[model samples]
Target chain A: MSAGTDTRSVTRQVRPGESPAGPAAGPGKTPFSARLRRDWPLLVMAAPMLLLVTAFWWIPALGNVIAFQDYNPFTGGILGSPIIGFTNFAELFGDPQFLRAVVNTLGITAFQLVFYFPVPIALALLLNSVVSGKLRAFIQGVVYLPHFFSWVLVVAIFQQMFGGAGLIAQILRDHGYSGIDWMTNSDTFILLVTAETVWKDAGWGTIVFLAALSTIDQNLYEAAAVDGARRWRRMWHITLPGLRPVIVLLLILRLGDALNVGFEQFMLQRSAVGSKVSEVFDTFVYWSGLRTGDFGYGAAAGLFKGLVGLVLILVANKVAHALGERGVYSRS
Target chain B: MSRKKVSGLAPWEEPGSVAGRIGKGGVLALIVLAVLLPLYTIVLTSLSPAETVNRVGGLVLVPDGITFDAYRQIFSDSVVSRAVLVSTGVTLVGTAISLGVSVLGAYALSRPGTLFHRPMLFCVLLMFVFFPGLIPTYLMVTSLGLKDSYWSLILPSAVSAFNVVVLRAFFMNIPHELLDSARIDGAGEFRILWRIVLPLSKAVTAVIGLFYAVGYWNAWFNAMLYIDDTRKWPLALVLRSYVVDSNPLPTATVGVNGFGHVAPPTLAIKMAIVSIAVLPALLIYPFVQRHFTKGVIIGAIKG
Candidate 1:
């Protein structure tokens, strides 16, 4: 509450040490000794979120301990289960379905990086070239709308357009051709999913690139023009360089999330295409854990996924810093 | 990388540049048309009569034949009507609760000094990069006895890490000078948050709130995974059944048109289902799009 003394000691831990940032640090910026005043209202304000995270996020994180145990939800609690050491990991590696999921996850991620990642940059460039603000904004709005649509709606929309009974198939049948099984065809499922991801997300993904482009000084373009640089040359040398930081930043972030090939997207369509096409780490856990009621085994796979993601983020962040670009986890 | 090469000299070469402008404009127009044409066709197909739709069979590209019969049939069923009501309830209630909880937490994090602020921030960030996977979360929800209830939809998704981070970044942009002034005016942190911070943050709040609302509205997988009760189904799940399973006709007690007969799965029915699911988001999205650039990009840049 603002009713307290306005001065507080700024003896904050720039490093991890000393007292945590709390309402106890008196209201004035002063020496550390006189700062032990409790601010109840501030603590009260911070309580709900902390409680929610601790309950939902932290508790579930702690539940990952089940991965190392022969845990039974019906019998022993998460921590009280018998320890099985590395057997879960051993089992996970030995399972063919799990191996398939690993390969499938990597395969989809690589395909997306190659296919879906660059279109947004091209789109941003096209948008930047459009001199009309109204038109650009309208198009941006139209494209970005799909990002807000849930995976359910997106999958439904795709099915309505391309499924065996969908419009395209209906058209093909009318034209004396066989109805194409685009949705259910396992061979083409990865491409279909990647295309859907682009359609739903690429437009929203352009925002950062556009923001970066907008920040580039217009005078540089004028100078390029004065130097008799062609439009294509100007774009190649100046525009692309201007967008480099954002591109690198986004790439690093994307690498950090490379394994997260989305859950709801794969889940809804997995039944249609069957596991051969749709099985990924997230859905694998969902099915094995919930459907088959193997909570401990699923938790082990999930814990493995989390550790991989964390390692990716950390490694990618370090790589970015080494390359002299600010990663998602900048020191600041 | 193979890039398309420009055919002619730069447009600025020729004065009046009319031909060059027309060429580029023509290409852009065609691109826009290609993108918009499918959406237009879907809407037209949804609007046309069932008989007309079946006759067309594929897509009614032009709107020459049109009727509201499909829309009428879609809204007529109690199952669909109830699902719409439930979806609306969940989205509105869920977004409000999510925003309230996230704003409180984010505001706390944005403040310079709060107990365990850095650790709290780190925890939130950890939620973004490393997830607790579906099994444990499903187990947690089930253990909490929320399986068949609307609370299952509302509570589990009430805290989106991305939205919280975005809002926290937005809140941090608030000048410390303003907080200093508010403190001098004898206002509590809550008063400052409610009166000063929130008033200044309408754009981000509205955009993030819209994101949450759309998320809840479009959520079907969670309901499919956790919700077993047909009565509490959302429009998205209903649409999924219609689209994926291709069954327009309602089950058992519910009648399609208050008759004992079941309507066949027509293109019109499928389109109508998609149209219904998309309507809310399409209608509401433009208003929120204005806030999106500033609201989202700032967060991404900072993060």
Candidate 2:
């Protein structure tokens, strides 16, 4: 739906999440039982969702207390697991594989922030600058194709192109070039993953900026051009400023999720590149905990990731504040 | 679907240098080609007959001949066939469950004056910020006796908070007067939602539904965690084992011809499996793509 034009609703819309219902429901305290009786149908509607969320997300979230215990699902499961405070954490911090996972995760995150972040904005601008709406739409559709491909398929496609027996290797062999398989090359692993991310998501990423670009008043561009400003100057002054709010919001989100480069991308490629280069936090948890039956230790590793994520959220909030803007979680 | 456009550029914009136009065209062409060429090759490879694959001795790059033997072989293979059934069933059932719960729950919270609305919204919002660790979820699934069951694949991921919020945003945008009028006519909340709100919000609902459907279709990790039986493996897990793990399925290792036929080249069969995994997304995505930007813009505004 288009944004409302009413002045009263415009002010009210800013706090819709926190606001009482519109004029239909007045803001007055009522006894719980009375309201419950009146809203029983609505309560029934919400029951299933509440039940599912509790079972899966909230319960499992609390069950991370197993990270502190020596968990044996056969013995007592989450209920009676032996609590050995900090033992799993001790083991987690001490383990070389876990260390590698942390380092690799952060390294990839920082690398992607630098290399992969701007690509969508630039591509969106390029697409925006195109002169034919049909061509632009076709290009948009084509590029978003890979985002829908499951990571397994993405890796498979990448393997077909860059694996030892893949097209590139075959071409190189035809020219008598010795041994080149980019998929397994540890030295370029970061770049390889970054390329995969760009190929798969960069187009999909443009959707938000494209929406923002649409919101930018066309008059600003016209006025700037009328002032004898060339294209580059108009883009820098008007277009970039117009895009600032969205850019900041996404950046803050990207920071809060900084450690998550995604699991499937790394997990699928781990065998080819070896754990030494490919073991990220999620994969580390999967391999070390699930495969080896070290549930508590794996839970500890996963919990540590969550803790770091929380810290990142704080740092993101600080950045948001410094920019004189709302952070990721506020003003909802 | 649209009238031919003279230009996407605005009137105030110059035509720009010829080189700039060409460079932009060149880059856009390359981006489109990069996406399509790999897909083109895979589809070609999947269709290539044995001799053509043997001639190429790798991924088929050029089309010399065509056959559906690879698809026929995989379909005949019990493992791939079973997996396909599982994937399709899960996707449909999971999407329905997710969309059902999300719609009911979103409408419940859509009215801000509803009981427990703030707390419920806060609870759902927590999903974005916190993830239950993988081991705990596995343990919970097992404890619930859902391990190795089809329900395990569906239930754990049944609700998407983002979808719920987006739906709620759309629902709240619907004029409250309609609901009030329905209530005045003695229409209950359920009837109001069913008869009034749903028909108006079909596009957002479809977008959210597709999201759940695609997620379920592509899901493998949950299956890998919970399903120990190869018989229960979904198409994605099967794809992973066959292609990414390079493990051969029984059918892919044998010929589908009536008698004494050599198996299709592994490359062709592998590409065939890849093609099968990718085909659904390719088919369903374009129809839903245009509707999604609105869904996203709403989320951006509401979030």
What do the candidate models score in CA lDDT, each in turn?
0.72, 0.80
Provide C-alpha RMSD values for all models, in order: 6.7, 4.3
Which 10 successive residues of model 2 chain B have the least lDDT summed?
A: B1-10
Interface DockQ of candidate 1: 0.35
By TM-score, the best candidate is 2
Q: What is candidate 1's lDDT per residue for B1-303, written digit by digit as tens?
A: 001222232444322255766666676676566446667777888777555665676667657666666666667667788999999999889988899988888787776554455577777766655677676777788888989989988887788776776677667677768876887788888898899889988998888788788889988878987888888888877877776666645642233555433342367666777777878988888787887776655443543
What interface root-mean-square deviation (Å) does model 2 yield?
4.4
Best by lDDT: 2
User: Which ranges in model 1 have alpha carbons more than 4 Å from their true place?
Assistant: A1-38, A324-332, B1-27, B251-265, B299-303
- Candidates in order, TM-scores: namely 0.88, 0.93
| DockQ scores of all models, one per candidate | 0.35, 0.54
Instruction: List, residue by residue over B1-303, the lDDT tens digit for candidate 2.
Output: 112233545677776776776687788888888899989999999999889888777877878988987887888789988998999999999999999999999899887776777788778877766678888888889989998899999999999876787777778778777788888899888998999999998888888898799889989888888998999999888889988888877755654467567767888888998998998988888888877666644453544
